[model samples]
Target: MGEVLYRQYRPQTFSEVINQDPIKRTLKNAVEAGNIAHAYLFTGPRGVGKTSLARILAKAANCLKLKGGEPCDACDNCVAIREGRFLDLIEIDAASNTGVDNIREIIEHVKFSPSSGKKKIIVIDEVHMLSKGAFNALLKTLEEPPAHAVFILATTELQKVPATIVSRTQRFDFRRLASSDIVPHLTAIAKKLKYRIADEALILVARASEGSLRDALSLLDQLASFTDGRATLEDAEDILGLPPFGMTQDFFDALITGGEAKSFAHVDSLIDRGFDMAQVISSLLQYLQMVASCKIQGAGQMESGLTPEDASRLREHASSATHEQLRRLLGRFIEAAEQMRYSKIPELPMQLAVMDFFAELQPQPSSTPSRAIPKADTRNIATTQNKRGRPAPQGALLDMREEIVGKWNELLEKMREYNHSLISSLRLASVIACDGETVTISFPYKFHKEAVEQRKNKLVVEAVMEEVYGRAFRLLCLVSAGGLDQKREATAEPRVVEVASSLGRADSLLDEAMKVFGKAEKPT
Candidate 1:
C-alpha cells in the first residue's frame, strides 16, 4: 500500500505547497540569489504549510545541485533530506523538547560544517513552545551562524515567539488557503485517489476544514476510508460530526416566526443527536452574525467566507428578523451560553431562556369593556399635597412625573425591548413623591428595588424619560421617610378622605353586617 495520504501527499518542492505562492516565490528567488538568511521565521495558522515549507527550505538549502533557487530533488542531499535520512538536516519538535539544553545542543552542532550537503539546516516546529531560557540560547545562533548553517523556525502563534528572536530572522507569513484554493486542491486529490467525491461534497469538506490543508486532506482521507471508494455528503457529515449548519438558522427562524411547537422539538432533536448544547449556542451566535452581516450588506455582497447556500439562507432569515429583534435574540443566546457553563439544571436554564420568546407569541389580553358614568357619579381627582396640608411645589419636577405617567406604557414597551424581566419588575414601582425637577419612585420590596437600581436598568429609565420629556430627567428611587419602609410598602394606596361625607342606609347596613360577621369568623 502507498504511504498515508497526508505524508505521501506532502509537498516536496516549493510549488507543491498550497495557498503560499508569495512565500514560495520569495524563497525561491532568495535561493537563486544565494542570499539565504542564517535564520528564517515562518508564522501562520495550522495546515497552511509553514512546517512543510520549512522542510522544503531545508532540502533546497542543502541540495548539492541547487538551481534556479529550487532544490534538485534527484540530488543525494535533497533525496536524503526528503527521506529524513540526511545527517546534515535536523527537524526538531520544539513543543516536545523545549529546554535550554535542547537549544544548547543545536548551538553546539552549528560549529561543524556539513558532512556531505552544501549546508547544514535545522527546522524547529512550534518554536513558540520553546522555554524562555531556550529562546535566549537560540538567539545567539540566530544573531550570527556559520556560512554553511541555516535555521528555519515555524510557529502557529506568532505572539509567543520572542521579539528579539523574531527581529533577527527573516519572516514569512503563511495565509489561510481560500476556498477557491482549497476546492481545486481537494478535487485534484480526490480524482488522483480514484475516490468518487462530488464537487459539493469536496466543498463541504473544504468549508469544514476552515483553511487547513492538512485538516482538509485528513478529513478527506477519513471520509474516503469510511465510505470505501465513494464519499457521499451524508458520509462526510457523519464522519465530521458537524450539524447541518442550517439547523441553527432554521431554529432561529422558527423562534422568530413564533413556531413554538417546532422550536422545542428542534432543540430536542439536536440534544438527542449528541450535539453539545454549548456548541449549539455558539452556532446560533454565528448564524445570527451571518444574518446580521447579510442585512448590513445585501445578499449580493456577503463576506468571502460564507458559502452560497449560507448566503441565501442568511438573506431569507434576515428578511424575517428585524434588527432590534435580532439584537434581543443574540443577547439571549449569549446569556444562555454563559449560563450553560455553570447551570446546575442545564436544560432548565436554557429552556426557561428560550421560553421567554414563546411568551411573546401569546395573544395579548383584550381591553376591558366600560360603561358610561354620569359627571356627578364619576370619581373626582385628588389634589396632591404635602404634610403641611399645603399643595406640593410644582414645575419641572411635576412635569417630569406627569410625563412619566402619561408615557408609562411607552416606557414599559422600551423596557420590554431591552429585557422582559426588567419590565416585569418595573411594573411594581410606584411614584411615592414628586417635587417636579426630581421625582421619587419606590418599589414595593427590596428585591424589586435592587433590580430597578441596576446600571442597565437606570440607563433604560433615563432613555425612556428623555424620550417622553424631550430632555433628561434624573430619577431618584427612594423609600419615603414616614410613609413606608423600604420593604412592606403597598404598590397601591387609597386616597385619604375628609369626615364630612356620610354613608347611605344600604352602606350602613353593610357595615353593621360586616361587624357582626367579623366577631364570629372562626368556624373551622
Candidate 2:
C-alpha cells in the first residue's frame, strides 16, 4: 500500500513546518540555548501541526548533530526519532491511557536516564482527556521533574486542562494556517508529484480545508487519485460536494436584483438539481462575504483568490447593494444556516430567512404627529362623538394616544424587569387605541393575545402604563385576524374579562367582590 499524503509529507524539521513563525523561532532559540523547560504545553485546533511540531521538537532536542536548533535528519538519533523507534523519545496518546495507572507508569519511567540521547522527551497528545486522578498524579511530576526528563503536552481544548498543570509548563499556542500559506505549499507538493491540478482546484481544496494543512493535503491526495493526476475545478466541486462558484454568484445576483420571486425560483431550481440547501446557503454566504469585502476594501486591494473576471463580477454586485442591506442579509443567512441543523424540513429555514429580510425592507406606516397632552380636564374633549357613536378623542386625548404609541418601546423595557415572557408577547402586538379609560392592543396571534390578557400580566401592564402615563388605564386585548388595521366589531367582543387596578383605592373592594360573586346592583 502507498503511504498517505499527510504522513508522507509530515514536517520533520523546524524549517519544514508551515506558519507558526513565532512558535518556531522561540522553540529554535530555546533548543539552541539549551534553555528547554521541564514541561511544555502546545494548544491549538486539530490538523494544524501541533503533533507534528511536537515530533520535530523531540527530534531537535535529541539530534546527535544539531545545527541552528534544527535536527540534522542524517544523524542516527534523528533517523530513529523520525522512524518512531527512538528509545528516549516516547509518544503517548493520553486519550487512550487516561487512568491514574497510566500516569503512574510515566512517573516510574521519569526517574530513569535517557537510553540513547541527552534528554528523555515524553510527548502526550490530547492530554486534556486524562482523568482527574491521572492529572493529579501527573501534577507533582510536572511541578518537579528530574534533570534529564522533558514533557511536551498537546491539546485542542485548553479549558479542560487544570490551571495547576498549565501554570507548571511553558505554553505555546499554535495558530491555524492561512490559505495563502497552504496554497503554495500544496502547489509545491503537486509539482513534486508531477500532478496536473488546476489553480482553481487548488484554491477550492485550500478553502475546503479551512486552515488545516493536513486536511488540505489529504483532500489533494484524494483528488489526485480520483482524476489520475490531472484534477480540474469540476473534479474538485464534485468530490468536495461544493456548488460551482458561478452558480453561487448567479443565485446571489438574483437575490439582490431579481427580487424575492426570482431568488426563490433559483432556490427551487437548486433543490430540483439535488443540491443540499445547507451547502447552498454556505456557498452563498461565502460569496456574499467576498462581495462585502470588495465593497469595503475595493476589488483591487483584495487577495480574494478569484479570477479577474470573478473579481470584477463581485465588484459590480458590491456596487449595486447598500452596506446596510449586505449586513442584514449576512446576519439573516447565518441564522438560517444555524436553524438548518435542527430543522426537519431543511429548506424551510432558508425560505423563512429570505422572507424575513424582504419583510424588514418594506416601508412602515407613518405615525401621527406627537403633540403634548394638556394637563387640564380631558372629559370635555373626550365627549365629542365620532361616526360610530363612540367618544372621539379630539385634542388632549388624541395627543395622549400618539404619545403613548411613541413611548411604547420604553414601556416594554420597563415590562422586562417584571416579566420577560410578557415582553416577547407584547412585541407582536400593536397599540391601536389609547383613550383615557382603556388602552386597546391588537395582536395577530391568538396565543400572544391570550398571554397578555391573563389577570396577573394585565395588572403588570396597567401598572407600567400608570407609571409611564401618570394614571392607571384598563387593558383590552383583541385577536385581530387582519392585524392592527382591522376595526373591532361591537357584536363580537374580546373574551378576556376586564381587570381593575389593585392599587390602593375605594373601588378595590367592589372589584374583589365582582371577581368571586359577579357584579351586583348598587342600592339607590
Candidate 3:
C-alpha cells in the first residue's frame, strides 16, 4: 500500500511545518545557538504535527547535514530517522508504557551515550498518559539528564502533565491548522496521488477535519477507494456527514425567528435525514460566523459557503439583529458543540441550545404560574371605593391609568410576542391606578402577584407598559385587599370623608378605591 498522505508529506524541517512559525523560530534558534534544553515538551490538540515535529527536532540535533539548526533530508541520519530506522532516536508511546517500570527503563537508557546518532533522543508521545508514579520516577533524570541524552515529550492535554515534568522542560504548544492552511496542502497531496478531486471537495474535507490535517488526508485516502478518485463536494459531504450548505441557513432562520416548535421541527428533520447533530450545529456555527462577519465587514468581504441568494438572506438576518445578539448566538452554538462531545444523546445538547436561544429571544412564562386574583365579579370595584370615601382621581394620572387599562388587552396580545407567561400573569390582574411614573397592578392572589413580580417577569410587564404608554414606568405589584368596611364600602361617603379615606385607601385598596375616581369596572 502507498504511504498515507500525512506521513508522506510530514515536515522534515521546521520551515515545512505549517502555521506554527513561532515554535519553529524558537526551536531553530535554540538548535543554532547550541542552547537545546535537556528536556522538551510539546503540547497541543491532536494531529497538528507535534509528533512529526518532535521527530524532526530529533533528526536536526543528530543530522550531520544540519544547516543553521535545520536538518538536510539528504543526510544519512535524517534519512534513517525518516525511514524509522535511527538507532539513537528512541520513541515511546506513553499510552502503552504508562507504568513506573517503563519510566525507570527510560531513566536507565538516558544514562548511556548515543550509539550511532549525535544524541540519544527520547521521544515520548502522549506523555500526559504517564502514570503519576511514572512521571515522578523520571523527574530526577529529566531534570538532570546526561549531556548525550535529549528527552522530548508530546501531549494533547497539557494540563495532565505534572507541573514538575513541565517546569523542567522547554514547552512548545501546537495550534490547530485553519482551513486555508489545510486545503492547499491537501490539494497538493491529491495531485501527487493522482486524485481528481475538485478544490470544493478538498475544502469540504478540510472543514470536516476541523483543523487536523491528518484526519483530512485520511478522508482523502478513504475517498480514493470510496469513489473513482473524481470526488465531488456532495461526495465529500456524504463521507463527512455534513448536510447541504443551505440547510444550515434554513435551520438558523427557523431557529432564530420561529419559536421552539419551528426550531425542534428543523432538528427533527435533520435527524430524520440521518445528519449528525454535531455536524449540523457546527455548520450552523459556521453560517452564523459568516453572518456576523458580513454584518461587521461588508458581504463583499465575506467568503461564505452559502450561495449568493442565501448569503443575501443571511445579510438581511444579520442586519435585523444586533451584532452582540449575533455574538451571543455564536457563543451558544460553540458551547453546545463542545458539550455534545461527551453527551450520551448528542442531540440533547443542541436541543438545549435551541430552547435556550428561544427563551433568550422572547418572553415565555414559567410553567407554574402564581395566583393573582379570585375568579369573581369585577363589578363591585368602583362602587365599593366610593363608599370607602376615596376621592376622584384628577387629570393626567387618571388619564394615564385609564389609557393603560383601555389598551390592556392589546398590550397583553403584544406581550405574547415576548413571553406567553407574561400575558398569563397579566390576565389575572389589572392596572388599578397610576401615580404618573409608577403603575401599580393589583393581583387577586399572592402566587399570581409573586409570579409576575419576579424580576424577569416584572421587566417584561414594564417593557410592555412602556411600549403602550410611550414612556418608562416603574412597576408596583400587589394582591388586592378587595373586601372593605362592608356597609360603608357599599355606600358613598361624604366629600370630607372621601378626602380622608382616599388618603388611607390609596396605599392599601385596589378596585374599591380606584372606583372612587369614577373609572367604571370594565372587563378583567
Candidate 4:
C-alpha cells in the first residue's frame, strides 16, 4: 500500500517546515548552540506542523551527525527516530493516557538515562488532555528533570494546560500555513508524484484546508486517487463540497444589487444541487470578506488563490459596495451560518438573512419624513426616563394619547417593516399614557418590557411612532403586574403637570404643522 501524502511529505528539518519562521529560527539557533530547554511546549492549531516540529526537534537533539542545527536524516539516529524505531525517543498520546497512573509511568522512566542516543526525548502530543492529577504528576518532572532528559509538550489548546506546567517550559506557538505557502508546497508535491492537477484545484485545496498543511496534502491525496492522479477545479469542488466560485460571486452580486429574487434563486439552486447550507453561507461569507478587503485595501491585498479573472471580478464587486454595506452583509451571513447549525430546515436561515438585508434597503413611506431626531438625543431621552418620574398628561396631552392609542395598531404594522421581533415584544405592551415628549408603555411581563427597553429595540419603536404619529416620541417601558387598566386607573385624570426639562425639547414649525394637519400632500 502507498504511504499517505501527509506522512510521506512530513518536514524532516527546520528549513523544510512551512511558516512559523520565528519559532523555527529560534529553535534551530538553540539546537545548534546546544542550549536546548529541558521542557519545550509547542502550541497551535492541528495539522499545522506542531507534531512534525516536535519530531524534528527530537531527532536534532539526538542525531549522531548534525548539520547547522538540522539533523542529518541519513544518520542512523535520525533514521531510527524518523522510522519510529529509536529507543531513547518516546512519544505519548496524552489523549488516551491521561490518568495519574499513566503520568507516573513516564516519571518512573525519566530516572533512567538514554539507552541509545545522547539525550532522552519525551514527546507528549495533545498534552492538554492530561487530567489535573496527571498534570500535577508531570509538573515537578517538567520543572526539574534529569540533565539528560528532554520533555516536549504539544497542544492545540493552551488554555487547558495548567499555568504551572506552561511556566516551566519554553513555549513556541505555531501558526496556520498561509495559502501562498500551501499552494507552492502542494504544487511541488504534485510534481514529485507526477500528478496532473490544475492550479485552480490546488488553490481550492489550500483554501478548503483553512491553513492546515497536512489537511491540504490529505485533500490532494484524495483528489489524486479519485481522479486517477489528475484533478481539476470541478473535481475539487465536488470532492470538497464547495459551491462554484462563480455561483458564490453571483449570489453576492445579487445581494449587493438588492435583487431579492435573484439571491433567493441562487440559494434555491444551491439547495437543489444538494449543497450543504452551512458551506454555502461560509462560501458567501468568504466571498463577501474578499470583496470587503478589496474595497478597503485593494485587490492586491486579497489572499492568494484567486485567478486574475477572480481578482478583477472582486475589484468590480468592491466598486459596487461601500465598506459599511459589506460589513453589514457579512454580519448578516455570519448570523445565518450560525443559525443554520440549529435550524431544522437547512436553507431557511440563509433565505431569512437575505430577506432581512433586502428589507433594510427598502424605501420608507413618503409620508414618513426623514429622521430629525439624532440617535444621541433618543439615547438621552431613554436615559432621562430611567432616572426620573413620568410626568402626568395635560389637556392636549390627553388628546394626543387618544390619537396614539387609536393608531397603535398602525404603529405596529409600520414597525413590522423594521423589526418583526420588536413587534412581537411591542404587541404585549399597552400605551397607558402619552405626554408630548414621551409615550409610557406598560408590559405585563418583565422580560417583554425589558426587551422593548433595549436601546436598539427602543429606537425602532420610537422611529415607528414618529412614522405613525408624524412626530418623534421616546418610549418608556414599565412592568405592570396589575395590567394596563389598573395602571391607567391609578393615574387617570391626574392634574396637569409641566414637562421635565430633560425630556422636553422645542419642536420645529414644520413638525408642529405635521403634528396638527398630518404630513402635507405633495402638489399635483
| Candidates' C-alpha lDDT | 0.68, 0.77, 0.73, 0.76
TM-score of 4: 0.73
Off by over 4 Å in 2: 301-304, 365-524
Tens-place lDDT per residue, model 1, 248-267, is 76788778884767888888
What's the number of clashes in each of the models? 4, 0, 14, 0
Candidate 4: list runs displaced more than 4 Å.
Answer: 301-309, 363-524
Query: Which digits, one per residue and each the tens of the lDDT, describe model 3 over residues 190-278?
Result: 88779899777887788888899889888998877678888887788788889987678788788667767998999999999999898
Give the TM-scores of the predictions, in the order they appear.
0.65, 0.74, 0.68, 0.73
Question: How should the candidates be ordered by lDDT, best one leading?
Answer: 2, 4, 3, 1
Stronger candidate by TM-score (2 vs 3):
2
Clashing pairs in 4: none
Give per-residue CA lDDT, model 4, range 173-230, as digits (tens).
8888888889999999999989999988998899889999989999999999899988
TM-score ranking from best candidate downward? 2, 4, 3, 1
